[model samples]
Target: MTIQRHVPATDAADRAMLEGWLDYHRQTLAQKCEGLTDEQLRTASVPPSDLSLMGLVRHMADVERGWYRRVLAGEDAEPLHYDEADPDGDFHLTGTETWQEAYTTWQAEMDVARRNAAGFGLDDLARGRHRSGERFTLRWIHTHMIEEYARHNGHADLLRERLDGATGD
Candidate 1:
């Protein structure tokens, strides 16, 4: 739903490479959901897996806000798709309308994350502490986010293929 495709350059500067890859992974997630009905998107990839394309979208939105807004930008961040009442709520099927909402929220978080990252240098430390009470750098967050998307995108590929025989990069 209005997702822009991103193709990472094979050669670029450090920041460009990192940003391009993150954007590429983000677009890959959207491509996996393309042309499917909301119900199709909500369909579990495999029995007992509870993994759906919508879930990936929702989960990533939660991650983007948590890392970029709260950690990197030092801003108050509330999860857009989940909470303590149900920590796994992001992956829980809600309704047919959830497809649009997940995508919208994910896109919004991506924008915020971009803006947050833009204000910092790669080595700049975050205001927030890790669970171990260690500070994180912008570079670490960017690398982690890319890896997160990649792992989830792998799940997305399988889910999409199972959903409707669709698959691609």
Candidate 2:
């Protein structure tokens, strides 16, 4: 049940600002999965859908990899590992892998994403194709990441609550 907290942001102004939210969001998600077993993490509390803590970890790994490796770096990232014939596949863990494995994958993806996100100017432009074919800038991507993490963190909070009675800030 032991979890390590991230170190505080340093004196670098840009990093302190840009990475502050990202760090907090990462910690929040980690906190959501704290003190849970593999079976509990893989259990889909909400029926009819396979969304679980392990699934969310896998999904986040896919997301970080997609955005940082594929979209940002143009590396032709394959679909998410859990995306098996269905677009929503990442929301479910369909295999026997342990929760620790999922968490490890998530950490790997986050490390890559953090490295990719570092040193980019807010005004830096990176192109992405959306459903509407709209062009986006790096600033937009950063904002979107923050928004996405926050939104998912809310869902994780509720999911964690359902998993265990332990809940708090």
Query: lDDT of each model, Cα atoms only?
Result: 0.86, 0.73
TM-score of each: 0.93, 0.84
Angstrom error at residue 147, model 2: 1.3
Between which residue pairs do clashes occur in model 1? Answer: none
- Candidate with the greatest TM-score versus the true structure: 1
lDDT of 2 by residue, 88-152 (tens): 77775656868888888889888987787664666665545543555455566666777877888
| Model 1: lowest-lDDT 10 consecutive positions | 93-102
How many residue pairs clash in model 2? 0
TM-score attained by model 1:
0.93
lDDT digits (tens) for residues 22-135 of candidate 1: 898888888888888888888886888898888888899999988998888777777876788989988887665567787888889999899889989988999786647678
Instruction: In model 1, state the lDDT of residue 32.
Output: 83
